[model samples]
Target: MTRLWIPFITLLSSALFTNAAQASADPLVTIQKKWAQCQYQRSQEKQQIYCFEQLIKRNQQALNSAPTRADLKVWLAINKSSLAGAQGGIGALSLVEEAKDLLEQVIDQAPETLDGSAYTSLGSLYYKVPGWPVGFGDDDKAEHMLKKALAINPNGIDPNYFYGDFLAEDGRKKEAIQYLTRAQKAPPRAERPLADQGRQQEIAAKLKELQ
Candidate 1:
């Protein structure tokens, strides 16, 4: 009868949806675990650049397998950034450039997914690296990226602290003080104290010098 056929079709559709959901969830967990391991190795800071390169290769494999997942792409970006740092520390300029390109792609694709962490990273990159037309660092670009990040997440401590540090460096003392103070009072206090402390200390030292 038509009634019996309708129930069978509905049950089959539900089962298919359940299988697809499971399939989607499994790859994400695997990628996250691999990324976590990479971060853990980075925190140790003793791993050779080759070790990070190997990690990158693994992450690249995972990413190729699941190109549609934004989180995987973000994780891959973070690993690339770390690898860049490691390479730069060893004076490997070409590798650093390659990593920067990868990070740029991640930012272009998913600027909203990682709580604006990519913006903060890009801002730090511009702030720390030597600029074009003269030096490696570009304070103006750093300021713009940091501002965009704060606009995306006004209460984010990382952007607030970094922005305040940049302002302080530029001699905008009062505004720097306000931002640094806000950063110190922001939540996730335990995680951000280093930035807060560093900014507040710099502000204090600068204010003292001015007086």
Candidate 2:
């Protein structure tokens, strides 16, 4: 019953966001909220794959309508990555590559969009994806970009959390703990209640493992 309710509620919430996005004049605001909704539903992969796929189309339309907005590109890229993760197979590589391309543009053309989120996200992709012929994953580059993101948004939860995860993966347990702890204490984003709540849970889980 609980598991069934989880997806039922997720679909209901997605419908509400869809309605709100349709009513919204500003696609950027709509995309941001919708992206948040899509991400929160991410734990339910098959369900979110469908949800985010629809969102990807909407985002492409939104981006086409206003190509000047870098943030839109960022969110679109993020939604793609979200979709790719939900898929998680050889076929998903294309989506990851697509997102990488979009993030590169955001980094070059709009580093400040969403407070250096491009850097953080790009860095994450580098570390998370495979290397060489398959993808462009590179630890050194990831570290450099993640640090740059931190420089731009020192107090941001994502930067700290990702850097901490990177550190943990690299066996720097103490350092990872420091950053993870900071991420746990980072300020909440009122505009992104769902994402904030989800992230806080992730931060807690990461902390538990390291501690």
Best by TM-score: 2
Positional deviation of residue 211's Cα in model 2 after best superposition, in angstroms = 1.0
Off by over 4 Å in 2: 1-24
lDDT by residue (1-211, candidate 1, tens digit) is 0000000000000011256558455544444444434443344445645556776687778779878755555555555655656555335434435545655676788776556656666665566554554334577777887787788867765667667766766778788777766665656533223334444455465445534
What is the overall TM-score of model 2 with all chains considered together? Answer: 0.85
Can you list the residue pairs that collide in candidate 2? none
Cα displacement (angstroms), candidate 2, residue 67, comes to: 0.3
Worst 10 residues of 2 by lDDT: 1-10
List the candidate 1 regions with Cα displacement exceeding 4 Å.
Answer: 1-45, 48-51, 87-90, 133-136, 189-211
Candidate 1 residue pairs in clash (backbone atoms < 3 Å): 129-136, 129-137, 130-135, 130-136, 130-137, 131-135, 131-136, 131-137
